[model samples]
Target: MAGRRRSGGWRALLCLPLAGAFSLTALSGCGPVPAPDDPEGRDGRAVQRMLDQRAAAVRERDADAFLATVDRGSAGYLAEQRRVFRQMSAVPLRSWTYRLVRTGGFEPARVGGRSLAAQVELRYRLKGYDTAPVVSAQYLTLARRGGQWYVASDDGVVDGKRGTEQLWDQGTVDVVRGAHSLVLGVGQDRRVLRAVADTADRAVPVLGHVWPQEWAGRVVVEVPASLGRMAALLGASADGYRGIAAVTTGEVGGAGDETPADRVIVNPEAYQVLGDFGRRVVITHETAHVATRTATSASTPLWLSEGFADWVGYRTPGRTPRQIAPSSPTPSPPGTCPPRSRATPTSASAATPTASPAPMNRAGSPAA
Candidate 1:
């Protein structure tokens, strides 16, 4: 879920940092712990109640009620939260909820009143957009004021690590709604966002043709200002993400329920260098991952998953490999590539139509 990083300490549990294209990993970092209290669970219940109200406020779009959950005495934190809520207005949320993970996950040295550091998890979905919820790890410094708990500061550290950067945290969120997409950008031009939406809108139908499953048919894209900002949002060093055009966040394998819509985070710098044909290929390729990966497990071989995506992406006849990667050397043959054991994507070629990609076993190979 992270693109990942240490926030002041409440970072999301993460796996599979991406490379030039994309990668998939399951999320199961934080485990549930018993209630903080021995029997009554009064203190834990109170904190959860306050958090419930906070989640309700966002769902209902009530600023005053939203602010009520925060410590009123903390002027600086209160003001900052005011701005965060206002920015959220542009984005649409279908569901929002908080689950208490564990108490005493961390200790905040300096606080105004009675404080308890807890690890929390936030699950939220964009209305008419997301199929499953996007999960985030939360750290809270809860304050007991007048016998009730108020969120003192969520920016606190958990286990000496901080959380990832959120889309809203960047700046004023500029939302562009395409027929089949929702583009959210910060410190980016409106024209750039619309183009992203248009590209995504076009990709959805193409995905439907090859991907035999139900999907939201739409995607939510996060467009940060620069490559560095993109890396920060992913919580990684710029070096790892430097030339990578984009990355997707979603479950690798799970078909019984509709998988969540992927957040196709774009690297503006790298993406811009890709011309019209190049841009279409990349966006379409990533969207195909969103569609086809519902049945792919973490143990699925890179060849099968990526090769499947490549198969779906470069569907146009006579397309060449150089057009996809640009920097790679051309294959010896003009329109076709050399054969291999499994259908993994090669630098100079895309997967063929008959390449037998199928259900994967934990050993990273096709099942019998």
Candidate 2:
């Protein structure tokens, strides 16, 4: 049987309206980001400036500038911050920005100076590889020192929530660049990353033939050491992506820098279980997302995006819809199109409309 898809996380978010999924990306486009309700109130604007400086430092690769944003008082976090900065040396970054979502998310105990907690949204794009930024949440606690607010720590707890775990947070990042793909992995062997790159490279050209549009024509694949870490990279619970082969992450209607490019993240266990043919289908399926992202938007509807990708994937290796019908089980559900049969003409009487459309998980394989 073919793999299944999902009805959660990336699939759902990617298709949401511009004001919904891509709302936080206000600063990404030509428009100005909405100022905080009280920009000049209680050091809110100060914190925003600090975040701006931090983003610039990352893009410029200036360690000193990056460290200036940290509060020296938090020794452990400071050291980890340094380590994370150094770890990013090999990964080429095209852009990085921080948007302060809100403040007072958590009230931290004061020690050296006055402190306040805030939730900040972090956005970054890999150079030459990402058109849109991989968006993540950062729970931060800032301290006032010498009348200036500094990032005290990122381990802030608001309703037991902390900053989202990034790939660098897990371990050292290893990069493998292909003609049409860039593979980033944590704690993965070179050969494994190579295989991912090779698979993605093969899929890109094939995808172009079907999806004739002006797209990146490339993909970025992230392979973490385990399934759990894969979930972490996506800031999702493992349950949402578990048992799935792979998932594509991206945004729509992005003519310029307004959205992030498509990413093909593999589920180690599930993806590895697939045979060669299955892997090709999965990779090609996700590559199609990269190719068709800007061509369609939230207005296109979920079924069109998913069903089209699935069709393109299954279409590759020269398989016809007739050949695929047998492997796909159609449960008896009310009001479904009747199956074609030699004994009877196409009629509702013989139709087994037992199931709803495949839950729109937008997965490359069987959903969890």
Candidate 3:
């Protein structure tokens, strides 16, 4: 049997607290003294400023500037920070940003006579390889030394201790670049990788023609070696995603903002079972999600979203309604279309339906 195409919705996942994930030693240094209001309040502002400075440094790609915000007193922490910067520098980045997702007001602890420690949630994205930026979250430790704040430590695990591998950390990756698309794969068969690249190349132009003009035409596809690795990328468990063909994920920007980075991740096991035509159809459908993600919302009907994707994927192909419907063991009723089908005219001049359509339930089934 052919594997089913799955459409996974995008949403933020909160997995664990920051302190439980990693350990860091308190950092201390010397700086100018502050006025005597609430010392904790002043330290909070300083920590915020430190985070802002660190974010700017990443965007600027300045190694020295980025390190200035780290605790200089901790040699081991400084070395780790330097290594991270070096790795980031080697990658081609379109943009990088970090925002503090506060769990609560900063809880300051007096570590020593002059040193302090606090915790905050950090949300960050490093957009590279022309795909949607992989959004990552971590709980971080900040310290006050001298009179300025510095990042003391962070839980570098992308998702949690269980998900220690980031995209870069996944063994060796081979990148296939096209005019408007980038395909990355790890431990994948070279033949399959090339096939995915070819499919994406063809799908991009079709998507450009079919989707709204406002969306950026670029697309990124990731083919992980195994379902376990793909789940790590998604910050989920393998069991939760079994039998899914592909899923599109990324942050949705607010109105007037461009769509945030989006990625189409393929299920290696499920995708491998598909024939050539099925492969293209699945790729085009997921690419449609990448193209239309910015304009889509929770309120958008699933039929419209999935139907439009199917429409684009099946367009110009000589496939019939029966061929396009989801495979089932039992036969479908004659002349009764699939619940999700939106009939398209056989030709431009074909007659249109004049009657009002029946209401559809949340599952896309016609209301009785």
Ranking by lDDT: 2, 1, 3
TM-score of every candidate relative to the true structure: 0.77, 0.74, 0.62
Candidate 3: segments with Cα more than 4 A from true spot: 1-40, 60-90, 103-136, 145-148, 156-166, 169-174, 185-194, 251-259, 320-368
Candidate 1 lDDT trough over 10 residues, lowest sum: 359-368
Error of 1 at 160 (Å): 4.8
Query: In model 2, how large is the Cα lDDT of residue 364?
Result: 28
Residue-wise lDDT of candidate 3 within 246-318, one digit each (tens)?
7777544343334345678888886776666667776787788778776777678877877787677766467
The most accurate candidate by TM-score is: 1
- For candidate 2, lDDT tens digit of each residue in 89-170? 8888888999887877576645476787778889888989876777777878888888777887787766665676877787
Which of candidates 1 and 2 reaches a greater TM-score?
1
Return the lDDT, model 1, position 219: 74
TM-score of model number 2: 0.74
Off by over 4 Å in 2: 1-37, 109-112, 157-162, 318-368
Pick the winner on lDDT between candidates 2 and 3: 2
